[model samples]
Target chain A: MNAELPRRAWLRQNAAAVAGLVFGGAATAATRRAASPHRLVWQIDPKKCVQCGRCMTNCVLVPSAVKCVHNFDQCGYCRLCFGYFDPGATELTTAAENQMCPTGAIRRRFIEPPYYEYSIVEDLCTGCGKCVKGCTTFGNGSLQLQILHHRCVQCNECAIARRCPAQAIHRVPVEHAYRMKSQAASVTATWRHKEDGPAHA
Target chain B: MPKRSRIWAWSWTLVVAASVLVASGVQRFPKPDFRSGYTVPQYTPPAVERTAAREWLDVGLLTGGLVLAGYFALARRSRRGLWILSVASLVWFGLVRKGCVCPVGSIQNVVLGLVSPADGIPWTVAGIFLLPLVAALVVGRVFCAGVCPLGAIQDLVIFRWRPLPLWLRQFLGMIPPTYLAFAVANVAVGAGFWICRYDPFVGLFRRSGPAGLIALGWILLLIGTVVPRPYCRFLCPYGVLLGWCSQLSRRHLTISPDQCIQCRLCEESCPFDAIRVPTPPHPDRAAARRRMVYALVLAPAWVVLGAVAGWAAADPLAAKVHPDCALAAELRTEESTGKKEQSWETRVFRASGRPLEQAEEADRDARRRLRRAWAWAGAWVGGVFAVRRIALGRRSELADYVPDRGQCLSCGRCFAYCPREYVRLGELDGIRGQP
Candidate 1:
């Protein structure tokens, strides 16, 4: 009987911790279930990215976390992209030495006439805002940082709020975030090449 | 003087081995542009290469080996062996591998947190980083003890001795798992590795970056006051994970009863409390039985309860028992005045792609199924347990074999390898401030 009182007293004193642990266990389980069918919370709107370079510069991480992604259809395949080359290139060429953005985030691929492919090496991106600035000012506003939704912290209020010009940034529901740009109708019409078709949705 | 000699000797040996491997690997493996970063370059098509050395290095093989070795030595009371193995792992993993094989990819977490996207976290890279860590846990800090380049580096530099109390150590140990769960969950939800953002060693090793190096330098310098390698003990979730692994280590470091001379030197020596009182002569049979019963009861209960509760929790109208879930958040956001907003899981049950009617009548069938599943599972598990105790009235013979992957992260192994865990400081004192 005496032991019962001590045990009850001990339980009462540690009630909060016990409750916290129980609650924590349930929360852990819920988090696991929620994680199973992963969703894209942040999205990149290909239409708005000016490639202003703000993503590289204004990001909180040391090696600016903003990595450039590609939209194969919209690219001009111009001998040069302000996104790739510096202020001015001596000539349109694929020389390793004469590129623009410092970290070589862009990779060029050849695919028939007037449509060479360009890709971003995400790990190499420093989010320096240089590419964004160049692309927005000189080329199609294609190379923008759309938060990758996967890499973003989803801060209640975004940390980059103060620096974002154009005011283009806004949160959307997670389900609708990654609305892939529709396939270019012309490409869809031509069934000559299976490889040249629209990307997976 | 004795420690410094060990450090010097190990450093030289590591340099030679690293140089040979790099040379051989360079010859055998394809080389990506090493100078690609430095040269003022635009978009260049860098060539890709396939090399076995690069593959293993990238996967953190050396670090894993070194950590395992260092912990083995520590557990066995060979200080010289501990220092050598620890140093080798850190140098190879950090300096040669170029910071790629890291579980600390916070970028993924950041993205998840920002967008709250519905895609599962990418496990490919995470799996690679965790493999060696898991191995270390199973075999003891074999990773931190000998292979983790970071722990190895810190192991070489530690110079002092002050012991922390057990209660405080346990308290601090508790913090990393929470951090790990949060980091992993956030990453799964699209947030990048959040913990890596504040990693102090990255700055220190790079030699010079931002002024944060000054703060890091002071942390290293404080080794003079307390025992050396403080971070492994108090921080480093990776180490905690390994310590748990060490408990079940297959190829473990064991004391040779004859070689020991019964000096009890190793007991005093272990900074991590790893050299526990030689497992009591005979295990406490009563306590063991009780623990076995508890685990036997709890394991099946968790699986059964988990499924049922998972179903119940999915109902939007149900009261939230799990905090911090995205589903729970959705439920909280629903602005129903009186009539309950139906659960997301419940909504999922309706004809696919069809929207739910706000009225409960539409959900009648779905609600019945949900309740039935929950009740049936719970009742079935409960009945089994009751029957087991009543029919057998005896203890379970088999031991529980739960994997440490989810719950027991591998950080403790790293802590065990570091000699600095012995240090007992009240709080981070007037440490040098960073600009």
Candidate 2:
């Protein structure tokens, strides 16, 4: 009976060894099947963002990693840029009172008679999404917010993503990290998928 | 070529193919006809995307740290080396990275990946997750001793501690497995990664967060000064798995360099209460046999009862936690009350143009998934309890005091406390130990 006990223990040890090997093999198989060279990081889907302004305040960084980026292709370049100017502003002058951005991040440049170019000065942008709300409402929604990877001390789980009412923030492969305003049409449809690369890259 | 090599080759081919699929992401639009020679500048995103290099670096650092921690605990037998490594780990993995690239949170990715293969885990996360487990399987939890930032932070803060009473320690030991079950279940149900959501030290690492959570972190740290690694011992889900692997370790850290000298100092020094003194096998073989039989018999019953309990509680739990379920509940209340002022969630749902039927359908699906996940989780927890019971039932012979293989963090604190260890280290002369 004592000899049998040792034998049984030996068998148990071997079984455990086999189980560990099987687990390792299965994990390796899964990794091989995945074959993903890219890492996953959090980003906002522009289509899903509700302009709740949580990105402005909820980020761990002091000034927030989220910044406004213009999709120039989608820009209307309107003489009256809704994103750059406040609706309540009595005059059309480029005054601090008339500017929509809290920090005056948007710079309006004249291109032609009816075309006024708008660009985002990222450092000044607070990612407040006030301009985003105005632009989405009145313009082509060209001025949208994106998480700048430079400033983003990429947390495993983003603080803003937890409270995002839109549930817009999600993990995407590094290639799809920049879900900017222009890629809005195509990015959300396929970005989350691991097997497929982004629509363009 | 062997089958394994062929498989590897095939995977590499697929990887190359995937990379080839990458195309220029630049999208251009027709310019507004301007008489002025105003050419639109090429679009360039302000910040470069964080490369895979950094994530790979994290994997390398983690591996190196674990190896060094094991060396310090075993070969060098230096607690000072472990402490210095702990501080370094706290600075790098804890503060510099802002608590990302963590093995503890990687369990969620693994769960999520397996649950939904479409959402496969990143290769780096898989590496990070498996490394510590593999290390633990080979040697006792060297990762926990000085490498894990969470443990390191707590360990560094430990000024002095009083070991909890055995009864309290055993009772509190139940918490980690329960925490693990829920955390795994939550991810399996696709609810969310609650571990990352509720990380205690994330606020401290980031240095800016909600005031309440930061205060809670500080409170835990204060408690940590009097209780060594309260989180690791009683709460960490990863620790439960590490403990199991550690229990089955091929090699484990020894209290003494050569052999124990029957000194009580090591026991006095150990804050974690992981030391076990020598004991003879139980005298009554019949009683021991009966207890073991009872434990084996009750294990199935425990699993069944757990599953039933889990199934019963699933709906109520999901309502409180699951986003879809919460949203549905909120929407129903708003409609029934005819409330005009809508919450942010309700406003978002209404604006989504998703019909109430569709939303309710999603909620039902989430609830069903949650129930299934809970049942599996419950069964796993029950199995763990059964294993614990069986271990407790067993009677074993030991010749000397030793660190409990399952609970020991391999921190090397007990080494100095052992008089024999001093003899081995040549601090005390004329004692023959391992040359």
Candidate 3:
């Protein structure tokens, strides 16, 4: 082919071949070296959350995938629950004005004398972490934010993770999806969080 | 620093830390004693719904798109076929998936994997990233023509040809490579993924995001109505890599089936301004040789100059982009002022009980790495463009107008405008087949 064409054309063709090898070769090598067996998705470690409320706004989803979660085992179940009631509130009722949660997402119910259970309304929970801040400061750190796997689009680099000042968001394996509190701690033992009980959704 | 204030800040931080740690482990009010009959309800949050099978399916669909795009561009030479395939790709990849594991964003994943010890790139993601480059090397930019959702979305809005002056086009062309260099550097230094952070079209695809990003997307699409795939030409980091392989394509797309007839219609037809007008043989071989020689000799100086400029930007980039460096700077301020800002990071750090020196040391290491990565990437960008200029100035053997291999996306748009193509398609009767 080169014998039929001028010298410059022949040289240019060969240069193209050489350029292909260099660029394609390097890209191919990078791709091969980058392979992994495990699939990973973005998650937030409940233990590391500082309740800065960045999770509420930083998510690409309109209403962020980050939601307020309750760890039932760790809850003190107190009637004067700090997560549900504002610090200055005179009444411990579920009145909107006295609620620590801006969206009124936390519901309080009487389970026993002086023992009340708190549950989060996922739709209304803005993940503001206002309640999380109150809970961590005044009560047991049972209320924390976790990235819901079902709603998470799983961006290559999670938008919320990048801005999370606490740096709690991390990539975890798909099997261990939610970093939820899973164990029932004994009275003498420290609270343990791991995959336990029938918690699959 | 005053001793009292220093002691005050330290004690305050420690007290909060102690309370938080104790709060996590110990219940303030006892969980009902063993004698009580209360049962704690189990609260399980949502689990992963999308499965491994979708990844395989994504890879398969991408491969099918690439194969179909190549066939439409090269074998069939039908612009209509290409557009149909492109719209389908945009719906599936852009609208339905809403942009995950895309080739454009995967560049960050590749660099992040190289820098960090986190699980290497997922096999599905690697395939998504590498498949296009492979196609470009074998054929030419088959990905850009119809397969890439980014290109497709931009392709939809382009209604007119508003070609910029040659000088401005040449100047703007350098952006993609420079953007690529900075994106890689940002990832290497533990800066957030700037590519995903500022992807102009993500807001449009997902139908919601920060107003600024959504506005940017709309503005680009508005400009694209006349400017024609502005992101593809000027901003896409991955397109720079595609251009490299496309230039060396084994079987390049030809604007004409047989020979260029000097008709100049293809040049008028292309919105991308990718068609190169014929350049007659040079009168002075010596002058041309001298010009090429000057570019080759001064290439190192261009690279060094670029590196120096990039090094200047590296300091601020490290402080602002990387999370740890920002934290370290905040810590330094607190140590000097003896007043805490109540930032989340500091509270968490104090509670974790890690020494301040360790964090400061990590920040120092991060800044140095970021600087070197920026400088090296800048140098590479400089060298690549210098070589590109030299190549652009060189002589071509053909006397007829031809497609620029590096720039032409091979979208098959020009195929309809060529008179020779009309004859090939049997739409014109004057010319039967090429003699």
Best by DockQ: 3
lDDT for model 3: 0.80
Point out where model 1 deviates above 4 Å: A1-201, B1-53, B63-82, B103-130, B207-225, B255-262, B277-435
Chain A only: TM-score per candidate: 0.58, 0.79, 0.75
Candidate 1, residue B367: Cα displacement in angstroms equals 25
Q: Residue B5: error of model 1 in Å?
A: 88
Of candidate 2 chain B, the 10-residue stretch with the lowest lDDT total is B21-30
Interface RMSD score of each model = 17.4, 5.0, 6.6
Per residue, candidate 3 scores C-alpha lDDT tens digits across A84-198 of: 8999897877778888988889987676677777999999998888988888777776887888878889887788888776777877667666675332223112111111211
Give one clash count per candidate, in the order shown: 87, 0, 0
Candidate with more favorable, higher lDDT: 1 or 2: 2
Query: What proportion of the true contacts does each candidate reproduce?
Result: 0.03, 0.29, 0.50
How many backbone clashes are present in model 3?
Answer: 0
List the DockQ of the predictions in order: 0.06, 0.30, 0.35
In angstroms, the error of model 3 at A188 is: 23
Off by over 4 Å in 3: A1-36, A182-201, B1-30, B33-38, B334-338, B350-356, B430-435
Summarize candidate 2's per-residue lDDT along B1-435 as a digit string, tens digits: 999999999999976764343222322223477789887655577555467787789899999998998889888899999989988998999888878758898877677666555566667788888888878877789999978989988887889988799778877898889878988898877677888877888789889777777887888889989988888898888898788777777677888887676756677788888888777788899999999999999999888887888787898888787888988988888889999328888899887788888879989999998998888888887788788889887876666788898899999888878777778767886454323
Query: Clashes in model 3: which pairs?
Result: none
Would you list the C-alpha lDDT of every candidate in the order shown? Answer: 0.45, 0.79, 0.80
